[model samples]
Target: MVPVAPTVLFLINEHIATEALLGEAFTDHGFDVETFEVVPAERAEDPAGHVTFPDPAGYDVIAPLGATWPVYEPALRDTWVGDEMQLMRDAAAGGTALLGVCFGGQLLAQTFGGSVARSPRPEIGWCEVTSDRSDIVPGGPWFQWHFDRWSLPPGATELARTADSSQAFVLGRALALQFHPEVDTELLKVWLAADSNGEALQAGITHDELLTRTEELAVDTAARVRRLVAGFLTYLAGQPRPS
Candidate 1:
């Protein structure tokens, strides 16, 4: 009998950037991917209402995606966000590999006794990241749309950084990135439409410009994500399992 592919559970915080590009990469690498929308559209009126999460121990991998809400908000910490953090901590303790992106990365840091706070300047749009380990986590003009940043977790190795913030880090079987490598043009359009706070406008970001940039970097971004996922899998393989 053919063995089942390793399962990856994506903890999607909102509808903005669903696992569009990254999900495809996981499937290509022989893993079955499933997403749990923490805040479904039906619950849009009350985002934190009646949320539920799956058992992290059941999956071989867990990836928490980005969210609109800030990770340090007291109200969120009192609700589903707190619950999600506990889930992440438990998953990590159980040796499940984690891939955190954007807000998700912040979650990983916060759960593992690191700190997350407002950046000196919010990083939006494409920006180049510097990495010593370029072959694994390449330096890039990568997509970034976040207002907050995280300090490295205890015992985590800093892999990449930009002038403004630490861009990526790894600990055990987990890897976290401050940028949205999972995003595609379609996802960017949704994010632009949902910008109720005029964040993009204030940052001088227009839909046409973002869309055009995404179109221009489509091939490169996809290739980068593929390499990132491949590197993550390699990293996970090298981690010692809890005995």
Candidate 2:
């Protein structure tokens, strides 16, 4: 019998920040991908519109992408954040693979009893990362743009880190990354044109420089992201399901 293509459910918080490179990587590995926007475009300006998450167990893999909204806001937790966290917890417990990026990583950490808070120093643009398991999580000047960091969930193994924060961790079938291996120059442009431009400038990074750097690193970055996704799939396949 022919096997069905594995499906990846992407929880995209903003229209501008869809799967990008990582989605391509998944497709290359024979997975079908679909996106569910938590914050719909019609309701982009309204906080009330951001209060829903789909059932994560339906998909073979769950990928929660970056978000402009802070994951630790009390108001959010009282509404959608709590529900989303619960969904992630359930998904992990059910043996669904999770690939969390930036804000999504914070959500995964929080779901596993870890915590997210404002970092003393926000990491923006390209920064160097140190990785103990370079085969799975490579050391790099990975793309990072966030004002917060996670403390990591209990029993999660730290795979990589930078001076300012923990960069990557693994717990069960989940792999959480503080840096954005998924972003491409096009996605970065959308972010720069939106609210993140000021933060980029504040970090002493300019749009032209960022775009130029992205152009220069495109080939290598794509290769790296592909490797990470391939490694994640391998890891997920080897994990024993909970009885």
Candidate 3:
């Protein structure tokens, strides 16, 4: 009998970015991919009124991707962040692997007894990180676009970091990251096009410069993502899920 391949559920919060290269990495790892947009485009500002999520334990891996909104904003916390945290907690309790990115990492941090707040300085464009666990998270010129940062959660081992904040951590079977390893030139174009708030420009990174950097690092970043996903599945997924 043919075995059922493992599956992944990638939550696309606020439509800030799609799975892009992340989805491709999962597919290459032999997992079926499901990208779900938890926040509706029309109601992104008010996602509290109507949002529903499936059982996180239903998939082998669940990724809460990056987002435009902060997880700690009072309005967001009241409407959806609180509920999503609960779901992630439940998923952790039930042996489902989690991979959190940026805002998603912030969510995991809060769910696991850490906190999120404004960063001293925004990290935009491509920057190199320092990773202790080079086997899992490579020190990279990874894409980063965030104004907030996460404190390392309890019982989490920080695998990577920059001067500003924790770049990557592992809480049981979950891996949380502050950088965007999924970004490629095409995906970055989408993110840059949606620069309604001039976030990148304000951070001192021009669109052209970031795009150029992204294109230059495309091959290496893609290889890094594949290695990351492979390392996560081979090593972390074998352990018990986060509680």
User: Whole-model Cα lDDT per candidate?
Assistant: 0.87, 0.86, 0.87
Residue 189 alpha-carbon offset, candidate 1, angstroms: 0.9
The C-alpha RMSD in Å for every predicted model, in order, reads 1.4, 1.5, 1.6
Q: Is candidate 2 or candidate 3 better by lDDT?
A: 3
The runs of at least 3 residues in candidate 1 whose Cα sits more than 4 Å from the true structure, single-residue gaps closed, are 237-240
Higher TM-score: candidate 2 or 3?
3
- Count of backbone clashes for each model? 0, 0, 0
How far residue 239's Cα lies from its native spot in candidate 3, in Å, is: 3.2
Per-residue accuracy of model 3 over 61-109 as CA lDDT, tens digit each: 8899988888998877876788788879888888898999898989999
For all predicted structures, in order, the TM-scores are: 0.95, 0.95, 0.96
Clashing pairs in 3: none
Model 2 C-alpha lDDT per residue in residues 103-192, reported as the tens digit of each score: 999989988989999999888888899999887888877999999999988999999999999999999889999999998998988888
Per-residue error at 59 for model 2, in Å? Answer: 1.2
lDDT of 1 at 65: 96
Per-residue alpha-carbon lDDT of candidate 1 for residues 87-198, written as tens digits (9 for 90 to 100): 9888988888899999999999999989999998988899999997876688888999999999888899999999999999988888889989988998998998898888
The deviation in Å at residue 81 for candidate 2 is 1.3
Ranking by TM-score: 3, 1, 2
Q: Could you tell me which residue pairs clash in candidate 2?
A: none
